[model samples]
Target: MILDDFLIYNTNGLYCKCGDFYLDPQVPVTHAVISHAHADHAVASNNEVYCTEATAAFMQLRYAKNAAKVFNIAAYHQSFVVGGVAVTFISAGHMLGSAQVLMEYQGTKYLYTGDYKIQPDATCEPIEWAKADVLITESTFADPEVLHPDPVVEIKKLNDISLNIMLGAYSLGKSQRLINLITEHAPQKTILVHHRIMPINQVYERMGYKPGKYQIYGRKLMKQQGGFVYIVPPFTFDSYARAKDVKRLFASGWKNLQVNKQDTLFISDHADWNDILEAVKQVQPSQIWTLHGDGRHLKNHFNNDIFVKLLS
Candidate 1:
């Protein structure tokens, strides 16, 4: 579908717009606006790119030279114009530097939400809902059957489960979210983190989220903490016997589903079905386009007035 003179294509990339930009003629447009630095969402090769400052730093570290052309914008609501499109950015709450891009052309406003999560987390700002004419959103956890436990409740459960319990999650976003939740809900207890999580923890700290006493993964540190919560990657759980002394919990958006029998905990960064409904009601957009994950399931739950398109 076309909006005004802008042409939207379901290219082999996350989200691409083709118009009056000249940098990457091979792709679609010159001014590429990105939602986050996730490998699938943002490509550093794009000549002129726009994303949050933290995302830019991450891209710079990953693809040094390619990141030089990036234009960094702070996560706090900010507006800028590119190619005659008045674009404003807000936090997506998915990662340290994730953002939702809102573009206004003439009088119509179009909002593109890059993978977002409504549940509050310490790793990033809470997702911000905005009203718009066209709302493009992510449906990563759109099924009603998927329901995440309340952050506070989950933290209490995790705390009471065992002293030497190890939680498995992604090193970047999920780790910080779990750590922050534990800090807020169970501040008295010192948390232990794996060495891989240290870098992202530093980034989160720079973003003003200071976690409580934590220890990085090492033989010496692991031996010292027999009753502390150790946050590690999901892959670590494959060799459960290695951590036999500690109980294990797997945290992810997928945990909301009953597909697995393993001890799964529902702690996700993505918005669940309830979050999607509320966000749609809050935004009240005339048109809604769903992207990523199961969009059709979410589309069926909304009102008929809102146009829904699945961008697979």
Candidate 2:
């Protein structure tokens, strides 16, 4: 690797010593390279941030306009030299403007897959494949037992429910994806979003991603009768637990511990076990470093076949 020992995880997050920058640092850093606008990946207190245009917009929405001291927005596939390392942002298809950080130095390419998905969605860019010497990937759904059912099937199930449904999701990426799914599969039902998701959804639409029709959630809507769909962040659902006609459906790869009786919608914005395996075969990286989640399944499954290690 051209960066050699510089590209390593430290107390904060992925730091590039030579470049004097961090990739998705957990805490505030002098220079941070954000992969997406997700809360866990993109924080508000950075001195400087480098990310895709849409990510910057989402960051502004999430953290307000003054989230960082300096924000540098890059177009997809555009390369910018950062402290002698050539860097490019490729679409990750995880969320609006989510990107895989590609760094090349001394002719060696390292690709960091920051929460990507191969599944196509109308609201964001599709995943793009590239060759790299090393692949730093997320294993959020790497277990063999985890197979994401076809989205059409899952969305169909959501459409079939008779009661007024309370669909819970992350306010950023997941909720927007669900809104699109609900639009395509269940056009007849009314779609309402929490105030938390409303601003981000507007940002997505302003970024030219049209996820069809949806309205903002209101207390008055909760009193409505019949089979309407209310999509909100998980906590928003908790605020309305006593609604009589509401049937809860939590949308995520994992189950919600707090809402035990609620149904799981099995909607994942990350790659599942099969998708991760497919990524391995396609990327053809010489060495694999697994981070995020347990990081065990990919390491165990590909150890004998390829060079693999759990970084986290």
Candidate 3:
């Protein structure tokens, strides 16, 4: 393994000195190589932003004229030069236009996986594997015991319940995925999405992703007794916390989010333990650098087999 730290994490997120750019920077920077359009990763007002086409669109939709001074959009696998480094974007499969940033400088390859998942997602691009010398990964669900159940089976749980369900999900990625899953698995429940989520859904549809059938949310639906699914953002979901008529279910992989709620739908857009292991195998990296979540489990698992460095 190379002795040099190809990438480093600080308050500004992942930085590449060779490239003179930040990878999914927390704060706005002069040159930002965004991995996706997620709020945390793709902040507005960057001088020059580099990302995929879909990511650009989402950013434009969210931040409007403030998205960036210049959008250097690149397709998946296309290599572009930023200072001394050659950068490439690979599909991350977490959400639409999400990518794993691959930076190559002085013969060494470093891959920064920004919120990736290996699970099949119809709403976004599938994760692509590329061999790299150093693998910078997210350890969100790195614990060995945190294996996520099959999403198909999890979504099917909605079919068993015939009540009006207030389903809470993130508007950007999770909501779209849930709509598709419900259409395929729980066809009996009519889909009602919040008005705020409609623009994003339209973006998904225009991008050629069919998220099945869903209508804009209406207050009248809440008066109904059964047979519908009201999909809303977290804020709206929390607002209806006291509504006693509908069954509450939040789709997420985090246990903390599922706490105090009996109806659990364990759906995640991040890689679980086994998926992380598989990503390591696919990347074929000699050195591993973890961030975003706890990396102690990975450090213990790799032990002497591979070098595991926690960036967080």
On TM-score, the candidate that comes out on top is: 3
lDDT of 1 by residue, 92-192 (tens): 78887888887777688877787888776766777887888877777877789877678777677665654466777777677887887887787665678
Better model by TM-score, 1 or 3?
3
Alpha-carbon lDDT, every model: 0.69, 0.84, 0.91
Cα error, residue 289 of model 2, in Å, equals 0.5
Q: Per TM-score, what order, best first? A: 3, 2, 1
| TM agreement with the true structure for every prediction | 0.84, 0.94, 0.97
| lDDT of each residue in 199-309, candidate 2, tens digit only | 888888888897778998777876777568988787877787786777877777775432545455777889998898888788899888888877777777776877776
The alpha-carbon root-mean-square deviation between model 1 and the true structure, to one decimal in Å, is: 3.6
Clashes of each: 0, 0, 0
Deviation of model 3 at 69, angstroms? 0.8
Each model's Cα RMSD: 3.6, 1.8, 1.2
Give the number of the best model, judged by lDDT: 3
- Residue pairs clashing, model 2: none
